[model samples]
Target: MTEQIAHEPLDVLRLRARRRQAGRRSFRQALMRAATGIIGEIKIASPSRGRLIDNARPPASIARAFEAAGIDAISVVTEEDFFHGNLALLSKIRRDTRLPVLRKDFLTTPYEIVQSAAHGADAVLLITAGLADDQLQPLLSEALEYDLDVVLEIHDEQELVRALTFDPSIVGVNNRNLRTFEVSLNVSKRLINRIPRHILAISESGLRSPTDVIAMKQAGARACLIGEALLGADDPRAFIAACRPAFVA
Candidate 1:
């Protein structure tokens, strides 16, 4: 499969965002309401772990289940290389559910940013691993101008420093070490508080239970972006329920 490029002009995307942008689900509002929000992810496979629920359930079915579980938001992995995901899946899930759909991909180019919005994403994930210093600001600026939320995903302190410069509305600390693909829940704990109080902090990957969720909250993360464990669970809701923090009046 040929990798897609940004053929659509930025102006065209801005016009379309105005004319056809779907009503926002207010993911930022959702985060403000909980101690530890769960952004349930829709993924078929991953680089470290392959083929999660390949033939077991379709994207729409899993989405319905997440809705039934009352997921705070939904992340649709759209990269095709190792993840077996497509932009079409994002559109399908977005149309079927009111949950804010995040286009979780290795998006570095402006074309991919516009394509993510055009394909029905309410938010887009931007990882700091491979992005050039020059490529960073334009992508961030365009995504915001296009009316899409940007989740600044960082794996370490260096990336965290760069992410803060952009002043992202949301920041994600990925527990998985991209080079080794090893997951450590501590990555979120170590990095969350360094982020300013104004930003919504998210911990991604390596979370498996309610205890893990509680720990993340204790460390100051407002949300957790989970994928594999939920997809592999016999009941994904149980996974979600186990992760939700006990809120008190």
Candidate 2:
């Protein structure tokens, strides 16, 4: 799949992406209406924790479970090398669920943005730490052209500054440090408030338990992206319900 992505002509990919005429799902609206927006992630493995779920459970089944659990949206890790995910899974999951699906990958090019739209992604994650200053705005623009929402991900104050320059509609504060692979909710706590209230703030990574979710909410996060905990849970629906704000009922 990596080889295909690398060798395919940009024109060909663009043509395919533009041909997709599926009705758009509004990721931004999903977060805006939810009492406590929860984006359940479909991931098979991670570099830090290794394999997260059995291959027997398909990605579409996971999407179904997330939808049933009342998650606001879905995030599918599409990077094949470290995350053991592929674009095919994104398309399959999108077909099976009503929630908006965000393609979570280290996307840096216009072609990747187009490919995501072609593969059924309602949104795309662009990390501030990974993109150069010149690359960030253009990539955000490309996603917008495809009618795909952007999740500008940042890990610190510096990246937060860089991300805000693009005036993104959504900002995702990732708690996991890219340098050491360490996880801390403090990262989210520190950065969330810095983002403007008009832009939706989403806390991502290392979140476990309702206490963690509440902490992020209190810290000013309107939403969160949760993966490992949900995948490892004996009852994902119950776990998700538990993670909701007390007022949600």
Candidate 3:
């Protein structure tokens, strides 16, 4: 199924996507209500670290655990080659959980956005590093057309500058450099405040503990996307609860 979708014509993919319902769970509103939102990820593998989890454990089962743990949203790595994920995983996770599911992939085309919607994604990650200047806005616009929230992901000052031009609703500052695949929390710290207060900022990568999440929140990030750490934890639900910020009464 995944291989077939990858080879399908753009028009055919669009038609399939359009046939499915568009209005999905809101990824934006989920973060807006939290003091510090936690987006638990269902990542099976990665290029930098190799396979992270036993793929034998169903993705939906993990998603259900996240929902039970009070996760604000879910991120599913759907990039086939390096991540060992596909849209089918996204679909299964979406069906099994109420949390808005994000499609985390190196998407470079409008067709992929439509495919995301067809597969039941509530949002899609658009990496600034992967997109050309002209390519960014159009791809963003395509996601918007399907009512899929866009996580405009950036890694540096230049990408941040380009992302701001679009006035993205949600900006994700990825700590891992796409080129080097090296992770750091300083990347989020350096850029979080630079993002306007009105736009939701999500700190991604290199976050392993509640203390790390607190630091990002203190630095002005409203949410943290934790994948590798959560998947590797002895108790993911307990880890998520600990990572959540204290709520003000």
- What's every prediction's RMSD, in angstroms? 2.3, 1.9, 2.2
Tell me each candidate's TM-score.
0.91, 0.94, 0.92
- In candidate 2, what are the lDDT values of residues 71-161, reduced to their tens digit? 8899999899998999999999988888899999999888788889888899999999999989887888888787899999999999999
lDDT of 3 by residue, 205-240 (tens): 999888898888888888999888887778877887
Best by lDDT: 2
User: Per-prediction count of colliding residue pairs?
Assistant: 0, 0, 0
Least well predicted 10-residue stretch by lDDT in candidate 3: 240-249
Q: What is the per-residue lDDT of model 1 for residues 1-249, given as tens digits with 9 covering 90 to 100?
A: 233444556567556666546575666777668544888889888766778866757888898898788678899988888998998899999889978889998887887787777777888888887787789899998788667888988999999998888778999899999999888988988999899988999889987776787888888888887787677678877877777653211
Q: Which stretch of 10 consecutive residues in model 1 shows the poorest summed lDDT?
A: 1-10
Tell how far residue 176 is off in model 3, in angstroms: 0.7
Residue 41 in candidate 3 has what lDDT?
A: 92
TM-score of 3: 0.92
**Candidates ranked by TM-score, best first?**
2, 3, 1
Residue pairs with clashing backbones, model 3: none
